[model samples]
Target: MTTTRDKLEMVLARLAARAEDERVFMGLYPEAARAAADAADDRRLAGVSLGPLDGMLVSIKDLFDVAGEVTTAGSIVLRDAPPAAKDAAIVSRLRQAGAVILGKTGMVEFAFSGLGLNPNYGTPGNAVDPARIPGGSSSGAGVSVAEGTSEIAIGSDTGGSVRIPAAFNGVVGFKPTARRVPLDGAFPLAPSLDSIGPLARNVQHCALADAVMAGEEPHILDPYPLAGLRIGVPRGRLFAETEGMVEIAFEKTLGLLGRTGARIVDHDIDDLLRAMREATLHASIAAIEAAEIHADWLTTRAEDIDPRVHHWLVRSSAVPAHIYLRMMRRRRSLIEAMDRRLAVVDVLALPTTAITAPLMAPLEADEVLYNDADRLILRNTQMANQFDLTSVSLPLPHCERPVGLMLVARHGSDRRLLEIAAGIEALLAS
Candidate 1:
């Protein structure tokens, strides 16, 4: 007899079978998934499963090291790297908890850029509109989940890599406070700001993935009630450049969040405009790290790297020591101010992306990524990094264009944020 577990596994098999042509996976290790899934089915049949996510399939960003696979970070330069001796810390935890490692997904080279484009690997098409881009460096991970290739997708967020694509695809993306997820096995982007998180079809899945990535017990928290919840509305730099429909979709989301009985308050912070400069920080940091990691290969095999990433590294190598240190220090001060403001609300709500995904064909034709690309992609997401907040991007309904209504809370408040998101998700779906 085909069990309920068999039905889900069949769905996954069909999804994974088409994974390659989707341009979403950097590489899918099907043998690994099959073996793991078969074992998982046995456990499920025996009624000895580990957790609710036991049988779930997880798609990982290429930046994460998986045993027997090179950690490419979507770069050709690492094509010769030795197969990883061990899985990254997060991957190990997910596996131990019974989540099948579906495959490695494509990402921006070196996980440097915000817009998910890889000249070498070919960018994954956004689910909403194939003509558009999938936000990166967690690009493929986003598409994998949104397209149902995986039950959940794990990715790293430097500035907005995780949230941008989540917003673009109308899925739930969560970037827990930077320090929450251990970064030992993943390729580094920005040591100070990089965090591993997840994208799921809904908030509950995201919450489960967050716990596994963070090495916490994966228990779903009670849903949030907006009745007495104080939600902060941004009044400064955060809303500086609102896209036409984005503004409409965001306002509509707020109205819904407000109608749920949450106490909405506006907050003013002139200093946020200053944080705008941090958009370049992750790229600069990633570039420096990339150069350090690829130093030897770079000297002789530079052309092997995607040109856009090579250029980003060259620019990053030029960052002065004092400037880098100042940016690092600035992050702390910004976090303090952000926390002070959040003291007034259970969560801060805003649009996750300033605009919808832009056309990729033109940029592909030009053989160059645009200059303003990162700015637009990193614009809204930088705040969570700036303030070191735990954030989730929830999808909105009633619009032809999908929007992510972002909800952010203070550091260590990830659990609460997920709970709040569950309520918001239920409301949106209803």
Candidate 2:
């Protein structure tokens, strides 16, 4: 039997072999991990098992607070912040479940950008191709899982932070309904929309980690039967501007599902999306809320913040309070409308991202390209947050580059979504 210590040593060796500049992790907890691994191994020797996650190698995003360490949230500005007195709620739960936390993974500064570029800590490259961007703000989480350094990686999904990187890196990422998992110690980008989730090599692992973090009893996911499954594809605007490769992969996956007796139909919510776009024309809820969170920093430490993030926050700060409130009120009604529309379908499916990971050089050197890519990359995934839904991104097979087929369901349907994803995952693999 492979001992937990054996797995820990292997992961440590792989991380050590990487160049220092690769920057998949912001920090590593080798000593603590080793101790945890030893404990797990001893328990196994005594014929005791904690659960499915026991002894699993997991990585956490930098935004999650670890006791006695500063939660940087991928920015240099927060380096001087006081150390956390206690672990984030999820961290504590993961430990209780016997997960050996390898380290804190890298993310976009303050979890702001979807392109995953962090000027402070270096961005980890795509797991498949080193030259391509790793989607963010859960950039490192996706890469860690894909590269085999971590079995499961925890990330915050405010606007596709978890799913985007998973899509780009060819891994599974699940974003539960907001507030499903406690966010007590996580540094927030947008508290209202922020959700704690996991990225892993498969749907089962993602489901396991999500359950542990949510303080639920982890159970084997009973895959939903594909036959007679109703899958609604919102194929109007969300499907627009998709790269040819992504579109092909998405359609191919849908075709497979259809052949398997899953019902595929066009479920148009373009009007709702358009309304959301118009409501947030001045600024998104995330941006406005983030601006409020960093208002002091924008005024005092403006020079220290990422220029791209700072610019958006600054713009968001300019929106009148009345407009922000009005937008929030309108958003609630839209959320209700979305829920009513979704009542007829089991889940809504779409391409996880509009395009695959773009090459890093152009995005780094060109501001226009960076902003455009960021917007496009975040377009599809952000809708889940806006409309209050549970979503997951499953990597589409046989693509030259990684692409994901995303499934979005009504809010608080996380378990059902996972079961559906598991069924789809099995179908795709078969």
Candidate 3:
């Protein structure tokens, strides 16, 4: 029988052994974590454990404010920033649920890129293949869980930050509706699109963590029946750049679901595809908003910001006000369009990433290569964010490496999405 302290010590030893390699945790609160574990053990002994997450070790992304610790958000610029005065809302909720937060994990600088290449703190390697890039901006968050340093990783997803890393590292990642989880203390990326979610071993773990973070009671999940489930696969641009292996994995999963009496429909989402493309032609709500939040720093301390992040921020200042306003108006129209299109289907399905994790060397060496890779990784996942949908990425079975099959639901459909994902997960495992 493993005690809470025993689990903590084993994880600590694993972290220590890898300390000399690529960085994963940006800050480790060993003393605090051990103390918290002791308390959880005491509660367990007294038969009064807090809840589902009592004694579970978790890692928060650097974007979250842990009281008394400066949030670096995977950047060097905020290292000297003042410590947080209070815990971020989710952190407080996690504490209330008796979750022991082990530390802060590294991330993409200012949560900018899908490729988690952090020059400031070394990027955490993919658990499947150390030489490939770990997806980001929640890069370390995914790696921490995948490598067994933590049971769950708390990360923010503006443009697939949580799901991308989860896909790369062979874990489950959930992105609830944008407004479902409060983002008060999280560092802003695109305020309109940023959402907090979990990277964990399975759908149930994500559900439990999400419930805690949302300030609700954690509940057991009953998997939805796969029979008669309506799953729509977008036909056009969604498949344009998909890699051979990803396509095979995805098609195979769809076939398996279909064999179990699932209704698989191909959707011609040309309007949705157009909306996504138009979003790129104008001011990115994420880039412009991120630029606004970091303007002062970019103006005075540009030297401290990551060049890739700085490149986008500096470019954002040139976007005309009229274009930004037009984009914002179009955003509402598109969200409505997506909702109507998805009304008939229980969920939309696609490969979480167009390509598998790429090697870091070429992307880092060339700006063009980096931007292209970033776009590919962010493409499919960004739709859910832009359309205000709830989504989850589940690892497909028997892939030589990890490949994620993403399932998306209409806005505010988080609970249903999770139940649906739970069903898919169970079906895949069988």
Candidate 4:
């Protein structure tokens, strides 16, 4: 039997061998992790187990509070900020579950962009192709899982942070309904849309971590039967601008599901999506809310912030309070409309991202390119956040580059969505 200590040692050694420029992790807790792993090994020897996550190597995004460490949120502006007085709620929960936390992973600045390029902390390259972008702001979280540095990685998804990285890195990422997991200790990007989730090698690991973080009892996942399952495909604007490979893979998967006793139907939501898009023409809810969170810093430390992040924050700060309120009210009604629309299907299926990870050089060198890619990368995943739903990104098999098939469910249907994802995962594996 491979002991937890063995796994921890292997991970630590691999991390040690990396070049200093590889910024997959912001910090590492070797001594602490060793202690935890040894403790877990001892428990196993004595025929005791804390839970499914016991002895697992876990990594947390930099935005999550780690007692006595400053939560940088992938920006340098907060480097001098006071250290957190205590660990974040999820961190405490993971520790209680006997998870051996490796360290804090890297993220996009302020969790604002999904491109994963962090000039402040060197960007962590994609696990599959080092030159390509490792989707973010949970870039390091996804890479850690893909590269085997962490068995599970916890990340916050405001607008596809968790799922985007998972898609690019070829792993499983789950974004529970916004409020399903407590947000008390996470740094806010958009308080109303922020959700804490996990990126791991498989759906079951995500489900286990999600339940633990949500303060719920973890249970065995019985893969929901794929036969007779109703999967709705919202095929309009969301399908536009997709890469050729992504489209081919998605269509093939749909065909396979259809042949396997699943019912695939066209479920149009373009009107609702269009309205939501028009409402945010000036600024997104995430940007507007983030602007408030960083208002003080925006004025005093603008130079310290990432230019891409600063630009959006500046634009969002200009949004009038009444307009923000009006958008909020309209958003609630749209959420209701979406929930009603989803009642006809078991879940919604779409490509997690429109394209696979693009090369980092082009995006980094050209601001225009960066902006366009960022918008497209975040486009589909943001829908769930805006409409208030639960979603997961499952990596597609046999793709040269990783592509994710996203499954979205109604609000508060996190467990059911995970169960369904597990079934699809097994089907694809077969």
Candidate 5:
């Protein structure tokens, strides 16, 4: 068996090669990681391995608190914030499961946007295509995994942060139901919408990390048979702006699933999109909640925050109390409607995003360009967040550019969703 130290040394060398590259890690803990790996090796020698993750290396998003380190959440504004007295709940879980914490990876400031652009820390180039974006706000987390810096990278998803990067980098990202894993020390983007998950090279990797993070025993995942499975394809604007490569790959995936005895059913989800769109116009839940979280910081350190992010907070702060409440009420009503619609299908399959990763140059040069791309990138993935559902983004190998085939399941169906995701993953590989 390969020793943990050997694997960890490889990871450290990788990080060192990119040491000056601020986009990947906000912090590195080689000393601690080496110590942890030594312990893991000792345990293995004694034949007392903790579990599947024992001796494995994983990276944490900067948004998560690592005991004795400040949680920057991708902004320099919090550089002086008090060091966390304890690890984030998930961090604690990962430690208990024997994962050597590699370091805290970069992110979009406060986990706000789908495009991982950070003015404070340079944006991490996409592992698949550096010229293009690696989706955010879990930008570095995905790259860390895609580049083999870590076996898995832990990240939070409010609106596609984890999934977008995973999709762009040609890896797997799983966003479980918001409540399945605790989010105690993760810096909030949108509290209600923020959910922690993992990005890895495959579905099984994500599943295993998820099990550990959920503080549950690592259990074997039996393949979920695709035969007779009811997969719903939402019919309407969800696919409107899909780029050619993404469209081709998604269609091909559907065809493959159909061949595997899966039933493809079209469900009209016009109302679902309509409701989410309306919510966007009048009540931005992310903005509202984010505004509250940063009220004090915005008042004092407005200049320190990213201008684009600050602008969002300004609008969020302006939301009238009534409008926010109305949006919340509408969200509940829409969730009920979505549950009824989804009951007919085992999983809702669609393109993770309408377009694959766009060039970062044009986006940076033009705010209008950035705005348009951001909206489109978040469009489909936001649906999962809005409805409080569990979702996974599986990479499409045949696409010219990386594209994610997103599978969404009803709220609280995380296990079922992951099982279906694993089955689809196995089918795709075959």
Candidate 6:
């Protein structure tokens, strides 16, 4: 769909001027289109393409610094964090790939909740069902890709931020190994747990976007048979907490994989849970880092932030050093345990979230219920972060509340993990 004459610019204009009656799901900033088009023209004339993703539009989560714009992170706190001297590293990578920086997509406030509620900017409406929650922190990122607002979106996953929205919105979102992408200029929710990932139309699209974002050579592979692939199913335990419908969906999905020649074996969720407790990646670990980041603002702009986020920030400041240290030690031990287990398994598969997306309106009204649901949303996905596993969440179909299958590989096996996930996606589709 590209022509030699400023193709990127043409798309930018078409997207920018598109009717507002179009979609409230994701927001776009196509103002950079002209410059992107010039860069595209320059690359074409030089007789070389940036990469496979040249001249495409990308939506960024609001948490990252986008040069000259505010890094809201779905909150009003950092309205003045010095309008990013330059784009976040990922944004720079997108530009390098000849991808147009479409705009800053929406997110959960302070990247705290799983439900995509933006009291100030207004939540990014879910395209699937108006009555259903869009899923958050990476809320808008998922909707952006699903609604065609942008082909791909870059979002952070502190606690299921990226994957939750993808599952809710019926798209693909992958949380790469923690350190795969540089977090230099991205805002932090929980430093140790915070990760940057992609929300795109499909697994391949996420792979493409991740390559550009991580500044690594892209690995594009066709789907392969699952036989000889040692897939681990943490059968009894992880499956224990799942609901009836969730259990049915999980079995059906596993059945599909079995039929496709994949070897499903036994695994225990205890490994992940153990790491999460040790790493303190949850309430204590995440809270402390966040408290440090917002130390100054918490006092100065305490009243400015949303009350829900303010509540979390206030509680975050109370995590003591002794607890934090012990947790770190625990983290190392858990990682070692995971490494040993993963060495034998080709991939570890689990549901992305324990439950499906909740209703938006009810969650909006009750803060207590909202917090409980947020933890429920974060249950399965956070374990990957605790162990620093490279994980990809794939949306599964034929279910009422859509669930995601998360496949994780030990520390930096992102490329291999993506390939494996692609196979599972193909099997499910078939």
In model 3, the Cα lDDT at residue 430 comes to 93
Question: What Cα-based lDDT does every candidate model obtain?
Answer: 0.80, 0.94, 0.91, 0.95, 0.89, 0.77
Estimate TM-scores for all models.
0.92, 0.99, 0.98, 0.99, 0.98, 0.91
Q: Give the TM-score of candidate 3.
A: 0.98
Please write out the lDDT profile of model 1 over residues 102-152, one tens digit for every residue: 788889888877778888878888988878888888998888788777779
Who is ahead in lDDT, 1 or 5? 5
**Candidate 5 lDDT by residue in tens digits, 1-430:** 7898999998888778767765788889999999999999999999898898898899999999988988889888899999999999999999989999979899999888999999898999999889989889999998889888989999999988889999999999999998789988888888889999999998888988998888777876777899999999986888887898988898889999999899998988987788777876854788899998899888789889998889889877988888888888888888899989899899999999999899999999999889899989998998899999999999988777888999999988888888899899999888
Q: Total backbone clashes of model 1?
A: 1
Model 4 scores a TM of 0.99
Off by over 4 Å in 1: 1-22, 275-299, 366-369
**What is the full ranking by TM-score, best candidate first?**
4, 2, 3, 5, 1, 6
Alpha-carbon RMSD, each predicted model: 2.5, 0.8, 1.0, 0.7, 1.1, 2.8
Candidate 4 on 135-208: residue-level lDDT in tens?
A: 99999999999999999999999999999999999999999999999888899999989999999999999999
Better of 2 and 3 by TM-score: 2
> What local lDDT does model 2 show for residue 59?
95
Off by over 4 Å in 3: none
Q: What residue pairs clash in candidate 4, if any at all?
A: none
Tens digits of per-residue lDDT for model 2, 303-401: 888898899999999999999999999999999999999999999999999999999999999999899999999999999999999999999999999
Candidate 3 residue 85 Cα shift, in angstroms, is: 0.4
